[model samples]
Target: MHSVQNTLYVMTPNAYAHLDNATVRIEVERETKLRVPLHHIGALVCFGNVLVSPALMHRLADEGKSLVLLDNSGRFKARLEGPVSGNILLRQAQHRAALDTEFALTAARAMVAGKLRNSRSVLQRGARESADPGEAETLTSAADALAASLRAVPGAADLDTLRGIEGEAARGYFAALNLVVKPQARQSFALDGRTRRPPRDRFNALISFLYSMLMNDCRSAAESVGLDPQLGFLHAVRPGRAALALDLQEEFRSVFADRLALTLINRGQINAKDFDEREGGAVMLNDQGRRQVVTAWQERKQEEITHPLSENKMPLGLLPFVQARIFARTLRGDMQGYLPYLAK
Candidate 1:
C-alpha cells in the first residue's frame, strides 16, 4: 500500500524556497517563514511568483519527489522530476495494451461506467438531502439519466461510441449539478455548465482549481507504478499530455473534486467574496481563497475510506495510487481487467 504524504503548496507571492541540510525552508523578505523536512513531503507545488532554489530542485528530483508549478489560478505551468523509474517490462506491457483495440475499448468502458455510477451516487445523495421538493425531483431525474447512461456503457461498440455516451451523460449531469448547491448560496455560486481554460463563474473557478490539483496527483500515481503517463487506454496518446493520468482521474473527479467543491460552497467555507473577477471575464480564487481550499483539501485527504476490492481502510489521498497499481496489474495480466474504484 502506498502511504499518503503531504503535498506542500507554496502560493505566497515572491516567496523563496531553498534546501537547508535535510529540510526545505521558505523565506519571504530574506526572513525564514517555514522549514520542513524534505522526507515528509511527496511533492512541492508552487503558485504564482514563488521561487525555488536550484539545490532544492536537485534534491527533490534526486529523492524521487515532484516539483509542480501552477499559476495563481491553479492552471498547470510545469513539472520537474527525476529520471523515469519503475518496471520496464510493466511499461512495455502497458504500451502494447494500448495498441490492442479490444483491451482499449474494455478499459474505456469500465472507466465510463465508474464515472457514471459515481456521478449518479452524488446526484441521488443530493436528491435525498435536498430540502426543496422541486430540487429533489430534479436531482432524482438526473440520477435516473445517469443510470440509463451506465446501462449503455456495456453496449458501446468502440472508443468513439463510448466517448459519445460519456459526453452526453456529462452534459446532463452538469445541468443537474446546480441543485446540489444550497438554495441560499445558489444565487451567488450559480454554474450554468462546466467551463475551463478561464473559468467564467465562481463555481467553475473553484472546481477547476481543485481539478488541477487532482490531475497532478493522478499523474504522479501513474508514474509511481511504472505506467507511462503518456500512454493511455481511454485517452489518446499525445505529446506533453498525460493521457493515462487523465484516464485514471475519470473515476475520481465527481467523488473527490466535485464533492469537495460542494462541501466548501454549501457549508459557507468558500463564497463569492473569495473569488476575484479578472479582465476578459475570467473569475478565479484569490490568495486567501486558495489557502482555504488547500487546507480543506488536505483535511479531506486525511479522512479514511474502505477500498471496495481490498476491503481494507485507507486514506482517501491514496486512492489514485491504489487505482494506478490496479491498472498496472491489469496490464501485466495479473488481473483479467481493470477495476475502477466505486464510491459507496
Candidate 2:
C-alpha cells in the first residue's frame, strides 16, 4: 500500500528558500536542506516570512503544485497559479455552461441543497449537544423543505430566481442560530466593511478571518479550474465578489467553515476571552485565538474526502479538481446533470 503524502508546512518568523545546486535549501539562522521528491509534496502552506526560490517556483509551475501563503495575522495574501490552458474553446465552454439556464440551475440546485442539508445538520448537532431535541426536529424539517425547493425550481433563467429559492432555503437554517449560541447578549460583526486591526471580539474576529481565508481558496481554485470566479448562480455577482467560488463553497459551508466555528465554540478552544469590543462596533480575535483557528483550518483542509463523481478518495484539496470535472462533464454532454459533493 502507498503511504499518503504529507503537505509541507513551513512555519517560521523569517526565512529564505532557494535552490542550491539542485537541492532545495531552507535557510534561517542555520540552513536545512529538503530534497523534496515532486510527487511526495501534495501542497505548500507557508506561515510567515517564508520565501520561495525562483527555481522552486519554476519547478512547482512545471508540476502544477499548489502553494497557499498565510501572513502572521493569518490573512491569505496570494495564490500563484491561474491554471488556464490559454485555449479559447475551453474558456468559452466554461462561460457557456456557467450561464446555461438548464446547466446552471442543475449545478446551483445541487450546491444549494448541499448547503441547506449541512446547515440543518449543524443546527441539529448543536441542539443535541445542548440537550435540545426541539431544535433538532426544526432543523430536520428545514433540511427537508430546502431539498424540496431545490428540486421544485424547474427552470431558473437568471440569478434572481435562484436567489429567491435560496432565500426560502435559508429561513430554516437561520431560525436555529439563536438556539445554538447562548444569548447573554447579541454580538455584532460591525463591518465598517473590512476586517482589519485589533478585532473587536476574538470569536467573531476568528470566524471572519478564517472565513476570508476559505473564500480566497475557493475563488482561486475555481478560477484555476477555468470557472468564472465572479459568476455564481446561488450568489449575486457583485463588484469584487467571487460568486462562482461562493457557489462551489456551498457543499463545504457545513463540512468546513460552519463546523470549525461550532467546534471552536463547543470545545472551549476559543471563547469570549479571545475577543475585544472595538468602539466602531467591530469584533476581533487576539493573537492566540488567531493561531488556533488557522491551525485548525489547515488541518481541516488536509482532511481526506471521497469524490462524489469519481468515487475515488481525495483531500478537500481536490475540491477544485472536482469542480473542474463537473463543469467539463456539462460541457462534454456526458452528464444529464451535475451533483455537488455531499459526504456520506
Candidate 3:
C-alpha cells in the first residue's frame, strides 16, 4: 500500500501544475520550479490562484489522489477526487450500518467516549506541567468533569442524548483551554470558550485552521477505506458536510491540533503579532504565520506515538488511516467492535 502522507501544498499564487506522464511538474513565471513523481503524492492542496492542468487532473483521478482547493485565508473551497474505490458491498454495509439504530448508537458512543478520554488526557497533562497552581487546579477539575462525561457516553439512549453528552464534555474541555496557555502570553492568547465562524480571538483563529487541516486528513482516511465521508453516526449528515470525517476528527483534536497549537503559542513560535484583526473583530493568521504553522504541523505529524488499541508505534499522521481501517473491519463484521483511538 502506498500509505505515505505526502501532501503537496501549492501556496504560491499563479503557480501552474501539469502532468509529464508519471511526473507532476510545477511552473512559475514560465520556468520549471518543482517536479514530483505521481506515486509520492497522497494529496495536493492548492491555495489561492494556482492553476492545475487537465492532464494532471486526469492523472490524479486515475491514481486516487485528492485535490483540495483552499482560499488564501485557509478556508476549504472544494475537493476533487477520483471514482470511489472498494466494492459496492462495503459501501452498502457502511450505509446500512449508519442507519441501523443499534449500530449507530454503538459507533456514536465509541467516538464520544474516545474524544472525552483524549480531551481529559490533554487537560491532565496541562495540569501536571502548568507553572501556576491555580491554573493547574482548574485544568484538573475540568479533566475530572470530562472523565465523568466519558463514563456517561455508553448509557445514552439516543443520538440526540449522546450529542448532548458530547457537547457538554467539549464545552468543559474548552472552558479550561485558557489554563493551558502560559501566563506570559495569557493576555494575548486567552481562549474565551471556543468562539468560531469568524474566530473572534487569535486563539480561535489558529484552532480553526488546525481543525480544517485535520478534517482533510480524516476525509482522505475514510475514503481510502471505501467509506462514505458524508455519512456518520456521531454527526448529522447534511449537504456539503463531511460528517464522518468530522466524527473521526473529534478523537484526534486534543492530541493533534490542540497540543500543537498550545506548543506554538507557549513556545512563542506564534504570537499575537502573527495574527491580523479585521474591522469586524475577526482574527486570522497572516501569510507568514500560516507558513510557520504549516511547517510546524508537518513536523508534528512525523513524531512517533504508540497506538493505544493496537499497541503499535506509528507516525501521528497515519493515525486516521489506521482508525479508518479498523472502522471498516468492524462494519464488515470482521471485528467484534470499533475502538476509537485514545491518547495515552
Candidate 4:
C-alpha cells in the first residue's frame, strides 16, 4: 500500500518557495513565513502567483515529487516531474488495449458502472437522511434512475452509447444534488445543474476547485504505476489532456469531491460570503475560502476506509493509486478486468 503523503499548497500571492537544504522554505515580503521538510511532501501545488525557485523545482523533480501549477480559480496550467520511471512494457500494454475495442469497451463499462453506482449511493443516503418528505421523494426517484443507468452499462453497444448513458445519469444526479444542501444554506450554496470553466454559481465554483485537486491526484497515480495518462478507455484522447486521469476521476467524483463540497456547505464551513463574483459574472472561492476548503480536503484524505476488494484499511487519499495499480494489472492480463474502487 502506498502511504498518503502531504501535498503542500502555496496559495498566498507573491509567495516564494525555495530550497533550504532538506527543507522547503516559503517567504513572503522577504521574510520567511513557513518551512516544511521535503520528505513529508508528496507534491507541491501552487495556485495563482506563487513563485518556486529553480533549485527547489530541480530538487522536487529529482526526488520524484510532482510540481503542479493552477490558476487562482484552480484551473490546470502545467505540471513538472522527474523522468519517466514507469515500465515501458506496461505502457505498451495500455496502448494496445486502447486499440482493442472489446477491451476498451469492457474497461469503459466498468468505469461508468462504478460512477453510477457510487452516485446512486450518494442520492440514496441523502434520501434517507432528508427530513422533508418531498425532498426525500425527489432523491429516491433520482437514485432509482441512476440504478436504471447502472443496469444499462453492460448492454452499451459502443463507447458513444456508454457515454450517453453516463451523461444522462449525471444530469439527473446533479438535479437531485440541489436538494442535498441544508434548507437554511440552500440560498447560499444551491447548485444550478453543473457548470464549469468559469462556474457561474457558488456550488459549481467549490466543486470545480475540488475536482482540480482530484485530477492532479489521479494523474499522479497513473504516472506512479507506469500507466499512460494520455491514453484512456472511456474519455476521448485529445492533445494536452490527461484522458486516463479524467477516466479515473469518474468513480471518485461523487464519493470524494461532491460529498466534501456538500459537507462544507451544510456544516457551514463554507458560505456565500466565502466566494467572490468577478466582473464577468464568474464565481470563485476567495483566498480565505480556499484555505478552509484545503484544510478540510487534507483532513478528509486522512480518514480511513476498507477496500471492497483488498479488504485492507487505507487512507482515502490512496484510493487513486490502488485503482491505478488495479488498472495496470488488468492491462497486463494479470486480472480479468479493471475493478473500480466501490465506495462503501
Q: Write the per-residue lDDT of candidate 4 for residues 1-344, one digit (tens) a residue.
A: 01237788888889999999999999999999888889998889999999999999999999999899999988889999998798999999999999999999999999999999999999988999999999999999999999999999999999999999999999999999989888999988878899996899999999999999899899989998999999999999999999999999999999999999999999999998889999887899998888888888888999999999999999999999999999999999999999998887
Listing every candidate in turn, what is its Cα RMSD in Å to the true structure after a full C-alpha superposition? Answer: 2.2, 5.4, 2.4, 2.2
Residue lDDT tens for model 3, 1-344: 11136889877678998888888888888888888888899888987789999888888988888899987667788999887677578889999998799999999899888888889999999999988888899899999999889888889999999999988888889989888888898899988888778888989999888998889889888988889999888999899999999989989999899999999999999988889999888999887778788888888989999987778889999999999999999999999878999887
Q: What is the per-residue lDDT of model 2 for residues 1-344, given as tens digits with 9 covering 90 to 100? A: 01123456565556665656545556676656445555676556676688887787776666676666767555666656525453456567767776677676667766776776666566656656655567556655665676677575555555577668767666655555545654332242122222346544444466567666667667656655566677776676697667777777777766577678766675666766666566886565655555667677776777888776677887775675576567556656777765666655
TM-score for candidate 2, residues paired by index? 0.71
**Per-model CA lDDT versus the true structure:** 0.91, 0.63, 0.88, 0.92
TM-score of each: 0.97, 0.71, 0.94, 0.97
Q: List the residue pairs that clash in candidate 1.
A: none
Tally clashes: model 2. Answer: 11
Q: lDDT of model 1 at residue 117?
A: 91
Worst lDDT run of 10 residues, candidate 3, spans: 1-10
Q: Candidate 3 lDDT (Cα, whole model)?
A: 0.88
Off by over 4 Å in 2: 1-76, 86-88, 127-130, 133-157, 181-203, 216-242, 272-279, 301-320
lDDT value, residue 138 of candidate 1: 92
Alpha-carbon runs more than 4 Å astray in model 3: 1-4
Better of 3 and 4 by TM-score: 4
Q: Which scores better on lDDT, 2 or 4? A: 4
Using TM-score as the yardstick, the better of models 1 and 3 is 1
